[model samples]
Target: MKDLGLIPEGYKILVTATVQEEDCDGLCWQYIHNEDKIKPEFVVSTEPTDGGIYRGHRGRMEIRVDVKGISCHGSAPERGDNAIYKMADILKDVEALNANGCEDKDAIKGLVKMLDPKFNPNHYEDARFLGRGTCTVSQIFFTSPSRCAVADSCSISIDRRMTAGETWESCLKEIEDLPACKKHGAKVSMYLYDRPAWTGLVYETECYFPTWINRETAGHVQAVADAHKALYGDKRIGSETAMNLRNRPLIDKWTFSTNGVAIQGRYGIPCVGFGPGAESQAHAPNEIIWKQDLVTCAAVYALVPSMYKGKGDEDVCQFRAGGTDTTSDKSAC
Candidate 1:
C-alpha cells in the first residue's frame, strides 16, 4: 500500500504480531524512539483476536498456591500420617466450602466464577474495559514426589486474567479470602509474586504487539463496518468486536495477550481486534488462516494505514472528525 502511495503522508504507522516474550517488568517501549522512553515494561505481544475489528484480548497474570502438609508412610498407615490423604480430604473440603466472608453476592458483579478452563470465571472482562479479556486460569497443577512418599506438600498455580476494572492487588485479595479453599487449608500464597501480565505494548522489549480498539463510530472499524454495511445495504451484521469462539466453551478474549497495553490499555489509542483466523486455529494443530480470511484481513489491515484521518502530533494518534475519545474509559471504548 505504501509503494502505491495508498498510505497518506505525515503519518507514522507500525504493524506487528503480538507473540513477543519477556521475563521481567522493568522496561517497555516498542514503537517509540529509544531516547523517548521514560518508563519501562516487560514485554509486547501480537496474538490474533477473532473479535471483529475493534475488540481485543484481556490482560493476564499468574500465581502458585502451595499447600503444606506433614508426610507419612503408606504401609503401617496408623503409625504415621499421610500428607496425601490429608490433602485429598482438604481438597474435598475446599471444594465444598462456600464463600464465607463476602456473602452479599450483590457486592460482587456478574456470575460466580468457577475455575474451569472450559468456563473460567475470570474469563469475563470486568465490566469496565472493552478490548482486553477478563482474568482467569490458563494452567493449574500440583507437585508430588514419585514412589508416593506420602507426599509432603501440594501446590496449584492459578492463571489470572485482568480487566479494565480489576487489578493485581484485588485479584490476590479475592483468592486469599476464599472461605472454602482456606478451610481446605488453602492459603492464598504463591512461590512467586502474583503477576498478571500488563496489556501495554509500550514496553522496552522488541517483542510486543501494540493493541487498539476503534469503535464503530470511529476509525478503521467504522470505515470497515461502513464498507460492510454499504455492501449489505444495512447497518446491522456483527458486534463492533468480540472474542474468538473455540472448543473451550469459555467467554474469553483472544485467549492470549498482545502489545495492546500501549494503544488501548495505556496512552489510550482507539483500537480494535480483527484478523484472518478463527480463535481455534491459533496455536492449535495445523494452525492456518483461510485464504479468504487472509485476503479480507489484508484488505482490512490495508485500510488501517489510512484509517486515522485527523489532527495530532508526533506522539499522539489523531481522532476522527467526530470519533469517541478513549483515554479515560478502559472497560468499553
Candidate 2:
C-alpha cells in the first residue's frame, strides 16, 4: 500500500515482532511500553482470531503455592509432617474452588460468581460476556532427602485465568483464604519472569496478565469491523476446509489471552484483534495457517489505519482488570 501510495496521510503503521510472548504473555509488550515508550493510539494484535474481530478475552497469571514441612524417615510416617499430604488437602480446595457453583449458600463460591451481579457488582455484565475465570493446579514439585524420607517441602504452580472484575491481588487472596491453605500456612505469590531473551537481554516482570475488553462500538473496534464488512461482507470468510468452523459471528472474543493484556489491560490503550489462522490451531501438533486467510488478514489490516476515525479523550476501555503493585523493571533491556 505504501508503494502504491494508498496509506493515508499523517498515519504510520508499525509492525512489532515482539519476543518472549510464549514464555510469558505480554512480557514483550511490557518492555515495549516501559522501555521503548512507544505508545500508539491503538494496537491491533495479530494473534490468530479465526477470521473474526476479537475485542478481548480473559487474562491469565502464573501463581505459586508453597507449603513447608519437616522431613523424617519414611518408616515413621507419623513422625513427619508430610508436605505432600498437606498439599493434597489444598489441592482438593483448589478443585472445589473451580468446580463449585455461584450459589449464595455454597461453601465455596466458584469463579462463576464473576458472572453474577451480586458477587461481581462492578463488572458482572462484562464478566458474563468474556466468561468466568478459572484456576487449576498445573504443576507440583517437592524436596526430600531421599525417596525413603518424608518430603520436607512441597510447591505447586497454579494457572489462574482472570475474567472481568478479577485482579491479581484478589486471585491470590482467594487462595490464601482457602481453608486448607490457611490451615497449612501455605504461601501464595505470583511468579516473576527474569529469563533472558534470544537477544540475551532480561526484562524482569511479574506474571500477572490483566484482563481487558473494548466496547463493541469503540472507534478502533468499529474500524476493524467496518473494514471487514466492506472487504469481505459481514460474515467471516475462510477456505472451504475452514468455512464450517469460521461460521460464527464476525465479532467475537478470543478463548485465549493475547498481548492486549499489557497494551490495553495494563496501560488502557485502545486495542483490537483481527488476524489470520484459527484459535484452535494455536498449540496443536499439526498447526497450519491457510494461505487465503493470510491474504485476507493482510488486506483488512491495510485498510484499518485508513478507516479509523481518531479517538477522543473519553476512555475507550469497556473493562480493564487491575494489575498488581509490581511493576516491570526493564533496566537490562
Candidate 3:
C-alpha cells in the first residue's frame, strides 16, 4: 500500500480476504457502511482467471430426477415395472439435453455442459441426489435388495447448474426438451431435490461470467494496456496476459461452481474475479502458480489503481484487464 500511496486515506480501504459469507451477507454488509456501519458498493474476488481480472459468473442450482417403478424377480422381469430401467432411459435425456443448447435470458449463455466428460458417466450408472445438491449425480438407489430381484423403486439425483438469473424450473425445462426425457416418463422437480441459488448479482455467479470483449478503440482494457506500456515502455510487452492457453477459446467459466456462490448468492454486491492460478490447479493435488506469472500478477495488483486517470471518483474502482485486448497506450492519470 505504501508503494502506491495511491488513494488519499480520508475515505477508507478495508482489505478483505474472504469475499463470501462465513456468516450471512449481513456481516459483509456491515463492513460496507460508508458510515463505517453498513453497505459497501461492490466486492472484488481474487479467484484466478489465468491473469485476467473477472467480473462475475452465472448463478447455479441443484436439480434432481427420481424414478419409481415396481419390482419383479429376475426370471419374471416382465412382472414388475423396473424403476432402474426407467431411470436408465431417462439418463439418455440428461445426455441429450446437453447435445442441445439452452437459451439464456442473460447475455451470458450455456455454462453447464452436459457433454462435459466429467459429468457424463463411463458406463452411465444411475444415481440419486446427495444432500450437496450437486448436479453431478453422487448416488443412485434401487429398493428391493437382491441382485436377482428387479428394482422396486429408484431415484437419480443430479447436481444441476444454472447461470445468473436461472432457476430450477428453467433447468428442468431444459431437461424436458430431450425426446428421451419425455419417452422415459422422466419427472423433474426441485422438491424431489433442487434448490436454485438466488440470481442476484450480489457477487459473481457461477453460472456465467459476464464476458469482456475488448475492442480496438477500447476503454478499460486499452487504458490498462497503456499503463503497462508507460511502466515498461514499448520495449517490454505489458505484464497483462493474453491466455495463450489452448483452452482459452474453449471456456472461461468453471465446470464446477466457485466461492462466487456464497458472495453472489447470499449477499448483494457487484463483484469481479481475478487471480493468478488456472481453474485446474485449484483444489487439486499438484496446485501451483508459475513464479514469473505470479510476479506479473503482483505487479498488476499493485499498478491497477494508478493506471486509470478517472474523470470522476465513481470510476476509481472500475478495473478492466486482458483477453482479446487491442489498444495502444494513452497514459492514464
Candidate 4:
C-alpha cells in the first residue's frame, strides 16, 4: 500500500523484518531501536488479529535446564553416570510445576488466573487487561560418547509465558528452586538471542519478552478505532468476532504474542494492533484472508497516519466531509 502512495505524503514510516524469530518470540524491533538506532513515536502491529484492535498480550521467554553426568562405556552401564536419568526426574518436576504451582507467592497469583478460565488478571491498575502466566517444557536433548557409550550430558528447553506481575528473574528463580533441580544440581538459565538479521547485523539480547497492556483511551488506540469508524461504520465482512465495529467498544487482548513484545512490552512505547486475518488462521493449514478484508484494511491504514495527527473533532468532520482518499491517492474519498 505504501508503494502505491496509500500512506499520506507528509508522514514518515520505517519497515523492518527479523531473522530467527519464529514462534512469535521476537526481539528485532528492540535491536533496531538500540543498535540500528531507529526510534519512532509509536508502533502499529498488523499481526494476525480477528480484525480487532489488539491492545496487549502475555510475555514469553526461553529457559534452559542443564544436567551433567559422567560418561561410561555402554558395556558396563554401572560404571558411568547417565544424564538422561537425571533429566527424566527434572522433566517430571517441570510437569508438576505446570500442573501444580511454583514456590513464588506472587507467581502463583498470576499462574492461577492464566490456568483458570473464570477471571483474567492484570497487575497494572490503569490497564487492567491480560490473562494468566504459564510454563511448559518445549524441547529436550542429551549428549553421549558413542553408540555404545552412556550419555554424559542432557538439557531441556522451557517455554515460559508471563502475564502481569511476572518478571524474567522471578520466572527463572522459580525453576531454579524446583525440588528436583535442587536434588539433582541442575543448572537453570535463560537463552541469549544473538542471531544475525538478514542484513547480517547481530544484535544480542536476553530472550525475555515483557508483558504490557494499553488503555483503550490511549491516543494511538483511539486513532485506530476512530479511523475504522470513519471508514466503515460497523459494515464489513464477518461478524463482531471477525471484525471490530465502530459501534462497539474498542477493547480486546491477544492470547498470543506479537512484535508488540518488543515495541511496547520492553520500550514502554505505545502500540496498537489492527490487522486483516483472524488469530486462529495464523500458522494453520489452508490459511486464508477474505478479499474485502484487504481492501478495508488498506483504506483504514491510509487514514490512520493523517487522522492521528489531527485534532479529534476536526479529523472526524473532515473525514465525514469526504476530504480523503478511500483507496491509493491523495484525492478525497
On lDDT, the leading prediction is 2
CA deviation > 4 Å runs, candidate 1: 17-51, 76-148, 162-164, 184-257, 261-263, 266-270, 311-333
Q: What TM value does model 4 have?
A: 0.78
Q: State every prediction's TM-score relative to the real structure.
A: 0.59, 0.95, 0.57, 0.78
Candidate lDDT (C-alpha), each: 0.42, 0.88, 0.44, 0.68
lDDT of 1 by residue, 1-333 (tens): 787675778655565332334442212332442345533211112245442443444444454555665555555456544445544554443332322222344333221332222333432333233333233333444444545455666665555554434444445566555544455466664333223345644333311222332333444345544443434323222222322342331112354555455545554444445555665665678876555555655655555555444423232222211112332223332
How do all the candidates rank in terms of lDDT, highest first? 2, 4, 3, 1
lDDT of 1 at 27: 25
Q: Write the per-residue lDDT of candidate 2 for residues 155-203, one digit (tens) a residue.
A: 9999999888887778889999999999999999999999999989988
What lDDT score is found at residue 93 in candidate 2?
Answer: 95
Q: What is the lDDT of candidate 4?
A: 0.68
> After superposing candidate 3, which stretches have Cα over 4 Å from the reference?
2-4, 18-38, 101-139, 161-166, 176-187, 191-256, 261-268, 283-285, 305-333
Ranking by TM-score: 2, 4, 1, 3
Off by over 4 Å in 4: 1-11, 15-20, 23-26, 101-110, 113-128, 234-250, 309-333
Report the C-alpha displacement of residue 250, candidate 3, in angstroms: 16
